[model samples]
Target chain A: MPLDPSFVGRTYPPTAPYQVGREKIREFASAIGATDPAHHDPAAAQALGHPDVVAPPTFPVIVTMAASSQIIEDPALGVDYSRLVHGDQRFSYTRPVVAGDELVCTNTIEDVSTRGGHGFLTTRTDVSTVGGEPVVAVWARYVIRGEA
Target chain B: MELPAKTFQVTRADLIRYAGASGDFNPIHWSDRVATKVGLPGVIAHGMFTMALVGRAVTEWAGSPDAVVEYGVRFTRPVVVPDDDQGTEIEVTARVREVTEDGLTRLEVTATCLGDKVLSQARATIRSAR
Candidate 1:
């Protein structure tokens, strides 16, 4: 079965706010070996004009990936999670994520198509403060490979 | 302009830690048993983990932690990690593709593992140092 093309351009509601914790940012930064002070020390981040410890550029994936499940897990979409492979990823940031920020994600199925026995799905996530201030836009392309 | 190369070590432990922190507890990133069952050489490193390392490289090149304005990558290959103390290594290199009038530098980045290209069309735009 193929994913419904109608899902394209369908946008989901904003998810519940996810509190950005300093320790979680620190842990993520540490896992990637990003030892920059701005990722750990709030004072250092403040010096850089951020409200608190700043997350690495890719940190929003933590929020957006979870939000995307609303679409991928949609029964009507016909997505087969077992065959999924990440095709690509991109991010555009309005500002670096800072600890203590309350963020929410609104996910949209930007495209859905099938070619050569594979299903291609693209999702865009709008990450913002719970107050509706835009933070970043994250896009992900995933492929569901069909059996030979 | 050419950017200095940066190398990152990817250990199985790092994969486990990244999985826990990122909430992407995908078994292919851990649990060799499942990975092999799924036809992978073994447990592999997460693609996002690799991208994050490249982001760190880009920021380091731009001389600031918050310099990246945009970044993107296509996962061309899976980085296979053998279960060993030494794990594996990824080497990142980039060239300045352009410097815009608005003071952003565009980078064309290449990431490789085991002498094979692991990412294609990998690029980043960053605020150039003053």
Candidate 2:
């Protein structure tokens, strides 16, 4: 099924605040084998001017992926989850995410198109502090394989 | 200038751990049955996972965890991992694209697995280390 082109430019409500945890950052760092001391030690991060343990650059995906469910599950949009594959990802950060920050995500459908028997959907997620300080803008493109 | 290349090994166990940590429990990354049903080569690593490893390499190059200002990648090919203890290896290499006067360094990165490029147009901009 083709995605609803009308969904382009549609923006969703801001998600509830997600509290970033030091442990969660540590776990993500460990999982990726990121042994940088700043990713694990508060003192190390503080020396580098961060409030707490610093998250890796790709860490925001954890929040954006969950927040994106608002669009992927929309009955009106008709996204077949089983056929979806990640096509592209990008992040532009105003500042690195810290362990103690409370973040919120606002999802927007940036583009929807069909090409070569495949459906392509692009989404932009604006992540910011609970107080509305922009932290990063994340973009993802998903390709839905056409039926054989 | 060319940054030192970094190689990371991807095992099935790492995928499970990443799934638990990242909240991405897609069966195509773990269950071979679902992966084959979906026409995948085998249980594949999450694209985010591969990106994370590249992020690690970028931070290492910059000598700081918070150095990255912009990062992006196109998932060009799947990094297939067999159900083996050795698994597969991903090698990441980067070249210095430019250094702006404002103390930012731009890098053009490439990631490959088994001689096949897995990511394309991979790039990053980081705060230059003092």
Candidate 3:
């Protein structure tokens, strides 16, 4: 079954605000091997001139997944969760995420396509501060294996 | 603070252990048959695993888990791990890019596996713990 074209331009409600905590950022950094003192030490970060330890650039994926759930779980989209695989991911940031900033994510189904009997779903999620200040845009591609 | 570099060898067991921990069971990571059937030359490593390793490097560098604030990366190439003595490894390099007045600093990063960039154009912002 093909994806409904009407869903292509559909947008989901912005996710609830996520408070950027210093600990969470540190944990994520450690998990990925980001050791810059600025990521862990306030004095180090301050010496370098940041408000607080900044987050790694890719941290936005944490919220984009929440925002994208709206489109992925929509039955009309005809996606099979079991068959889905992460195809690609990319992020463009206007600025790095910082502690003390409340962030929100909004997801849009950018495109739907099929190839080799498989379904491809592309999503564009924008992360912004509660005041709507743009922080980053994450583009993700998911591939659903053929249902044959 | 001065940035440091680290490297790690990713083995089949490591990938399997990560699979159990991360919940990403993509067969291309652990099954040779499935990987080759899917058009890959051989079994490959998960991009997120590579990303996670980069984070490990950061954490180890910080000397504590609470120092990092943010991290991000783009998967540029696939890392294929084979079953042999010629094991595979990834080298992660980082540099302090800039610091904001609010006390956050941005670090530029890169991860290379098997002489090719598996993660590229990576960056992270971290706050000082004081």
> Which model scores highest in lDDT?
2
| Local lDDT at A110 for model 2 | 99
Give Cα distance to truth, residue B71, candidate 2, Å. 0.3
lDDT of 2: 0.95
Error of 1 at A132 (Å): 0.9
Q: Please give the lDDT score for candidate 1.
A: 0.93
Order of candidates by TM-score, top first? 1, 2, 3
Q: What's the TM-score of every candidate structure?
A: 0.98, 0.98, 0.66
Candidate ranking (DockQ, best to worst)? 2, 1, 3
**Model number with the top DockQ:** 2
Tens-digit lDDT track of model 3 for A66-133: 66778888887868887777766766667667788899988898988888888888898889999999
Q: Each prediction's Cα lDDT score?
A: 0.93, 0.95, 0.75
The reply for model 3, stretches above 4 Å from the true place, is: B1-8, B11-45, B51-88, B91-130
Residues B1-130 of candidate 1: C-alpha lDDT, one tens digit per residue: 7888899989899999999889999999988999999888889899999999999999899888888999999999999888899999999999999999999999999999999999999999999764
Q: Among all windows of ten consecutive residues in candidate 2 chain B, which has the lowest summed lDDT?
A: B34-43
Give the Cα RMSD of candidate 1: 0.8
Q: What are the per-model DockQ values?
A: 0.88, 0.95, 0.17
